[model samples]
Target: MAGERDGETLKRRGLMLVLSSPSGAGKTTISRALLQEDHNLVMSVSATTRPPRPGEIEGKDYFFVEPVDFNLMINRGELLEHAKVFNHYYGTPKGPVDAALAEGRDVLFDIDWQGTQQLAHKARADLVSVFILPPSTAALEQRLKTRAQDSAEVIASRMSKAAEEISHWSEYDYVVVNDDLERCLAEVKAILTAERVRRTRRIGLIDFVSGLRQGY
Candidate 1:
């Protein structure tokens, strides 16, 4: 549909922008930048069975929970999507995401391809999935190694998993090869703008246009 200036015909629905990438592909950094720049966007805090890292806040970095509690959420259908990664269960809760979308706010999900798939199936209309890839496999390995948090063995494991993760690129709606973070962030912002202005999202446009015809 064409752009309508009428107030009643330009209402927007909430959007779910899922960013999927390998462990070292920079989705976390890009997602944070997007949240900082976009006032209407909120990051979806995942519930995890893993312990919080040193400086990581409980409700901010993740909703740290026991394994049993994580399993309970999965069984209760409280999580929009849940997956086991590196021996820890991570999931996006249903309540907050639904509430945010209902309020016409966008929720940013930093998750893997598996979680993205589940979110797509659950919130098919609201989702705008994006996959991020490193500029090259060599760059990906270098990035993983530069992170001092992992040991040599762990880094190798992550590098191995990266290949499998990159294989799912075709499943997502959009793809960004993150050679330059700033340019990638700009592209992401453009995608969000376009998705928000999509015809189906502006439900009130029809009525506003109708009113305009009477005035004309």
Candidate 2:
């Protein structure tokens, strides 16, 4: 298959693209847009102890493991990052992500700041984290209401949590205020494209340059 650039297929290590945001800040929507558009990117399926809600599939949405099995995974060091949120355990399994990276396919993480930190600690070179922010607190609250995914009580709780989540914006490599969806998405794609061509990630460049020197 052709690589990121057209025609020439130069090998490069894949990246871990992390998009984090408060519940109503549009990270999930941005993530979905990225996955739909980028063939090289795949979402990292997480294992969670939380029960599946309406229209959620077993392996696709989440692994949906029992708490016992999740603990076992933690003990075995099979999870890259694990955290308890809203009384349920959620974690990223290590195996699939590793395989995808090795094959030059980027893995996208729709995880929190805590999980982003863990991934960075484990593989700093491969991680490119972006924190998405809403335009305003009132806009964020309205978005939660518009989505109608959560009850009024739940939306209130999320609004309370948004401030804390937004505080971690400095931790990410890039920050995007998602006031305009198209602009935000374009900026994200620009970031990804630039990161892909960085010298460290382009391992095949060594051989390509060597060939050029020989020809000269």
Candidate 3:
């Protein structure tokens, strides 16, 4: 939505904002905050083989599907990216994302490095990726424990995997070390604000400028 106030309005193409992080790195928290604040951004609803949990809505929370259907989608190239986690298949449906992009509505993705890599391959021009890192390993472990949603064994497993996930930091366009939640969220919002105005992303800037030249 960033634009200059020339004679005409500048239109911008939508972007795919991706946030990736190791478990307990605060990417989810940041994503949630961004969604709450940004009315123009929508979360990419993924399809999953897992059944809906309590209070979860179909199509909004996820497009609940059978494993066979998920595989069919993968085979037909209907998915932007698909991954198996904990024996459940999760993927982003290409149709909705494409529609949103064509309408100039930004799509936000809370996915891992693997999914991000797939999206980059398919739509690198529209993708703006950020990697979130915890301030320290101990802080990461502490945040995992504080959640209390996972067992000690699961927390330990996630901690073990955290190092490998952090290694992919170099793949991201921007990296934010989450020492403080508010500060990190502000940094991410700043990144999105700046990227929104990038010359290449602004779709009709050339025409707007041309119109300005004619006026002079």
Mind giving the per-residue lDDT tens digits that candidate 2 earns over 75-141? Answer: 9999999899889999999999999988888999988989999998988999999999999999999
lDDT per residue (tens digit) for residues 1-216 in model 1: 344355435668889999989888899899889988899999998999999889999888899999999889988999999988779988998998899888889999888888888988888899999999899988988898887889989999988888899899999999998999999999999999999999878777677768678883
Top TM-score: which candidate number? Answer: 3
- Model 3 residue 3 CA deviation (Å) reads 11
The Cα local distance difference test for each model comes to 0.89, 0.91, 0.92
Candidate 3, residues 93-130, lDDT tens digits: the string is 99999999878789999999999999999999999999
Worst 10 residues of 1 by lDDT: 1-10
| Ranked candidates, highest lDDT first | 3, 2, 1
lDDT of 2 at 138: 92
Candidate 1: which pairs clash? 9-204, 9-205
Query: Runs in model 1 with CA error above 4 Å?
Result: 1-9, 51-58, 66-69
Listing every candidate in turn, what is its Cα RMSD in Å to the true structure after a full C-alpha superposition? 3.2, 2.9, 2.5
C-alpha displacement of 91 in model 1, angstroms? 1.3
Give the C-alpha miss distance for residue 128 in model 1, angstroms: 0.6
Clashes of 3: 0
Against the true structure, candidate 1 reaches a TM-score of 0.87
